[model samples]
Target chain A: MISFFNVSKVYPNGVKALQGVSLQIEKGEFVFIVGPSGAGKSTLIKLIFREELPTKGQIYINGRSILRMKRRDVPYLRRQIGMVFQDFRLLPDRTVYENVAFAMQVVGAKRSEIKKRVPEVLKMVGLEKRMDDYPLQLSGGEQQRTAIARALVNNPSTIIADEPTGNLDINTSWEIMECFQEINDKGTTIIIATHAKEIVDSMRQRVIGLERGKIVRDEHRGVYANATT
Target chain B: MSTGVYMQMLLLRQAYYIFQEVGRSLIRNSLLNFAAVGTTAISLFVLGVGVLLVINTNEIAKTIESDIEIMVYMRHNLAEEDALTLEPLIDNISGVQETTFISRDEALKSLVKQFGDEVEESVGEENPLPDTIKVKISDPREVNKIAAEIEDLPGVESVRYGGQDFVKKLFSLTNWVRIIGLLLITLLGFCGIFLIATTTRLTIFARRREINIMKYVGATDWFVRWPFLLEGIILGFFGALLAVGVLYFSYGALIAKIQETISFLPLVNSSAVLFRIFEGLLAIGIVMGAVGSTFSVRRYLRV
Candidate 1:
């Protein structure tokens, strides 16, 4: 579960990225954050991971006030929520298996656990056959799947994906969305921030729309209301 | 399994991973690792050479100082029997090791051997060289003190040891060499640290993307740091070991040559001192390497 209470963020250069944004996301909810460029969507996602603290108000994850969390505890907090970037940030030199295994390794998971879990997660992402291939050898969709597998390897309760389909073709994007839908069906809360209008309208999920640093809409089974692309 | 056994296994696995990561990164960035190792070895070698020079200089100074002898000249009219009586007085001085009485005739004979028979003929029947007691002291530092004491002895006219100004200059020279060597070692130590730090920084910068990915996946700061720290330490260890190897053989050859060419110069025997220097160099190398990596990786570890 995630909650934001009157959260606001202002950059040092005086740009307001988010303004008094308050919302609650329930457990196991698959949600879409629909917004255009410069709409504070990225900042919202960053706040969930404690990448950037709320400038004026409190944010909580699973009833814990992350704003007051100690610096040393931030990593442990991150372990509870997986993150995926638009760029598919996999280490190019590392194979898909190593990249996924690294997630478990970081948490000091036992070698036996890592050995058991990494392949299982790769299979879940449907990349089991390509697990030994380097990221450079994988297609864009496969690379993104590898990233997804890495995110899932830690068994995080929530996945915050910023523009998960930003770099993929429509067909590939849908495949990736199908993976997210499957992951959410298994009760992992999913919050995806994207500008893909067709996918949002087709998915028919809970949608929150933002424009100019403020949320203007929140709807159940929502469509992409503003179609400016 | 028992909890204690499980914990031990976990620690062992963690150590294995750390070492594996260190080796992987070293090979991945082989050029940079090589550069760091080379720089560390050269810096440690310079430091080792400075240490050897200071040690040898101190040894030479001690040898030279110990070789100094005080010549206690008998009164011009004093008989040989009476001059020999002054020997006991010279020998009784606190620092005196031994005393040898050189009769005036013997001194004249040695002078004539040096200046040929013309000097002997010039002196003719009158031998002007004084009957002197050559006094060796246990400590060269006490040479001036012993000389002063011997000067006051009965039937002794004057005592001449190494000139006071010359002795002072020699000590000051050795002290300066030691101070300068120490300063140079400190300076080169920092230079080595900086070089290793810079190389590590560059290596980390090249892998910044991998580090960023690690952070996103919840890698702790220390987890990310272990490999780099280990890499730095390895570089330092190998660098220092190589330098020690080179210094061992080269210093041995140099000492051998010095002994053969200038046999009288009291060089420090290699076996007695080189091993200690090797140990010191190794410690310095490893410490510098680890410190350099720690310092360089600090900025990047903030995730």
Candidate 2:
């Protein structure tokens, strides 16, 4: 579970990105953080990862206040939260298998555990047949799936997808969303930051809408509200 | 298996992977790796020659130190027993190589032979020169101690030895050679580090998307750091080995030719000394490789 209490962030240049925002995201929940181009959507995700600190207020992940967490403790926090980007971010030179294996190897996982986990996760993403293929050889959707497999290999409690389908076609975008939904159903919290109005409207999941760094509306079944609001 | 064996196996695997990665990357960027290896070889060769010169100069100084002599002049009334007893005691000193006792007649004859016609006719039947004991020291620095002890001996009139000015000069020369060698090697090492750092940075830059992805997937700093660090270390170790090996062979050949040309001269035996120097060079190469990679990787890992 993640919680934010009156969290505010002011950049070094004195631009306030978030203003006293408070929200609670429970375990096994699927939510979308939607906003216009500059409406603190990225800031909110960065806060959860502790990549950027709040200027004021407390932020908690699993009941631990991360605002005062040390630099050395950041990795452990990251291990609990998996992240995916719009760009597939698969290593061009590494095979799909090596890329997935790398994620586990970095955490000092045992060889036997890695051997078992990597293939299992690749199979989960339906990329078991393409394990030896490099990222360049795979299609855009397949590459994103490979990335998602890498994320799932660690079994993170929360999966943060920042514009995961921004570059995919409409059909492929839905396919990616389906993958996220399946993972969320399996008891992992999912927070996807996107501007895809159709995606948010189609899911009818919890939606937190942002405008000019302020939460204007939040609904359990929000519509594709216009940014003109 | 025991814990020790497990750890050993783990380390061996890590080492193997590190080298495999290095070899693969080197082949991928063969041109750049070659440039790095060439630069290291030239720098090491210059550093090696400087070290050789310093070693040979020190050997020369040792030879000069052993040949230095001091003379103790005895009084005209010195007794045979006292003089005989003094000879044994002086010979027992640590630095005393050997000693020759000369009587007045023998001293006069040596002076006549040295001065030639001038002393031959001027010195009549009676000898004018005092009998002195000439002492050779194994170490020149101990000359002063021997002279002081001899001066305090019974029937000793005066003790004379050459000034320490020559020995001090030799020491300064040898020290200068060492400083030059150290400075050249340090400068070469710095160059090697810069090259490795730049190479590693470029390699990282080329695969930046991969790094960005790793960051998204929640890779730790060290997790992100390992492959790049390993990459640099591999580059450094191989470059150093190549440079050191080439220098050993080429320098060995050169030294052999020089020895053959001047076998009559008491030049330092390059054959025996080269092995010791080759070992030292190998150690320097490893350090340079390791250190160069470390400096190169630290900056890129900042993110």
- The candidate 1 chain A region of ten consecutive residues with least summed lDDT is A220-229
Best candidate, DockQ: 1
Q: Candidate 2: TM of chain A?
A: 0.96
Interface RMSD of each: 1.6, 3.3
* Candidate 1 structure quality by residue, lDDT tens digits, A150-226: 89888899998999999999999999999999999999999999988899999999999999889999999999884
Model 2, A100-142: lDDT tens digits are 9877765556678889999998888888999999998988899
Q: lDDT tens string, model 2, B1-303?
A: 998987676656555544665567767877776776666666666767777776777777777676689988887777655676678888887778899988777777777777796886777666666777889988777777878987887788898888888877777887787788678777866776677667666766766666665565555665566666666656555665666677677766866787789654344555667777666666665566556656655554443
| Residue range B111-194, candidate 1, lDDT tens digits | 989989999889888888889888899977778788888887788888878877877788899999999999999999999899
DockQ of each: 0.57, 0.39
> Which one is best on lDDT?
1
Best by TM-score: 1
What is the alpha-carbon lDDT of model 2 when measured against the actual structure? 0.78
lDDT, candidate 2, at A161: 88
DockQ of 2: 0.39
Q: lDDT of each model, Cα atoms only?
A: 0.89, 0.78
Which residue segments of model 1 deviate by more than 4 Å?
A12-14, A226-229, B1-4, B77-155
